[model samples]
Target: MTTFVTLTAYGLADGAVLALAALGFVLIYKATAVINFAQGEFLLVGAYTFYSSFVIFGLPVTVSVLNGVAIAVILGVAVERFVLRPLIGRSPISVIMVTIGLSAILTAIMQLIFGTEARAMPPVLPRGSIEILGATLPVQRLLVVVVAAVVLTAFTLFFRYSRHGVAMRAVADDQQAALTMGISVRRVFAMAWALAAVSALIAGVLLADITAVDPHIATFGLLVFPVVILGGLDSVPGTIVGGLTIGLIKMYTFGYLDPGLADVIPYIVLVLILLVRPYGLFGETRIERV
Candidate 1:
């Protein structure tokens, strides 16, 4: 049916972006055991940076994109080195609270610098639409899916075979063992944050293309919590599955029910999944002795 095809297209595009964002959450958690409450703020900063460089400043798309990504990477490294590194042995709750405070700081800074207005970017993708069944799908949406797929594939290869990727995996598995093997745990932590920022930057650009750039864009990062949690916070592949499932559920709600309820659906699913599987469907269960 036309509705089915239309929903499917939107779902896949949205899901891909969500998966990208959620991957960042998983990477940081797996690598350093710190929940980055500021993940969404990374997206906010990247989107605004791109807007300033490309739209307001009139730079070339490639240059602006690189600038945005560079800013994200630098911020990630700086946060790790200055804000979090000192708290290395602190309680998880303390680190989590620090990230929460960091999020507030980042949000305040973004609002102060960018203001609260939404800024439209000049269309970078070819402006067009494709017909799917009886419904029309935007070429931009299709491009989002393609870009996400490429990034996912590239990262999969990187993690499976690359030296740095292997190091990260080892560090995640057991930090003490990795350190004993001569791996720089601090370096790995920094790299995880940097990669997470890169992923957030990509998601920010894609989502900004769909919904314009604004302070509210950062809230999309918050949405990733449900995706990561539903998929298993520590499971990368699960992020993809959770994203797709969330997207489909959202689209189904919009198509069959009220469009206004779309935003509420993800959290609803999150709650249900939490109730059913506290560790997530693909997440590993660790037994801690009291």
Candidate 2:
């Protein structure tokens, strides 16, 4: 019972981070019709940015977080403006390859800037444990879940009511119609990238706080694929559900099943989901007639 409680708590935290990363991926895909392979690099760069600011420069924690956000916005916009914007209307294969190339380049740059050594994440969250249902749960994990929920809620509201958010949604639904309606598709695209980066930045920081500041954080971003796939690539609400579900599955696998299975379970679920429902739980289905 204690073990179950602990695993559930940790799983929620993991799901929260996954949701953030997957949110970014879904945003870019929905708005720009592009699957950004560099999305994981966004997490990599953001985590290191925070690490560099606090550990290396000794900045205030608040300032360090803001710095991470700044870098994310800059990196996101720069990628969209310089690399992706020009490739608009090109072959999908070309765009996909370019994004893959971008990921490699970003990875290289990160390694060049910070050697491949793993480092401790700044212990920012409160350190302690709380007794819940006779189980001692880490405060950090609970805080992670809370923080992620708040951020995700804020984003949900932003998308629901904000003007720019509406515009982005409009563009996502139908780019041609949005363009005809006087919406700037280009700006929407840029905003999508920037927002995605920011979400990944926050997720990167949270996950690093739980684990460590390591190169593997970037690879962890790949997990977003399964989350988004499970939740529905273009469904915002689906991302959250998918993330939490996957997180719980992983934790349960780690606790009760073969621990090795935890790492691979999400992908396996992804494959099964594809076979059963290719559109995902909330994803829209489109039919075209020639």
Give the clash count for model 1. Answer: 0
Best by lDDT: 2
Q: List candidate 2 stretches off by more than 4 Å.
A: none
What TM-score does candidate 2 reach? 0.98
| Candidate-wise lDDT, in order | 0.89, 0.92
- Flag regions of model 1 displaced more than 4 Å: none
Model 1 CA RMSD to the hidden true structure, in angstroms: 1.2
Model 1, span 1-290: residue lDDT tens = 98899898989988998898888889999999999999998888878888889888899999998998899899999999999999988898999999999989998998998888888888977679999778898899889889999998888788889999999999999999999999999999999999999998888888888889888877878888889889898998898898888888888899999999998988998898889997898999889999
Best by TM-score: 2
Could you give candidate 2's per-residue lDDT for residues 132-244 as a string of tens digits?
A: 99999999999999999999999999999999999999999999999999999999998999999999999989988989989888888898888888899899999999999
Q: Ten consecutive residues with minimal summed lDDT in candidate 1?
A: 118-127
Residue pairs in clash, model 2: none
Scored against the true structure, residue 185 in model 1 reaches a CA lDDT of 96
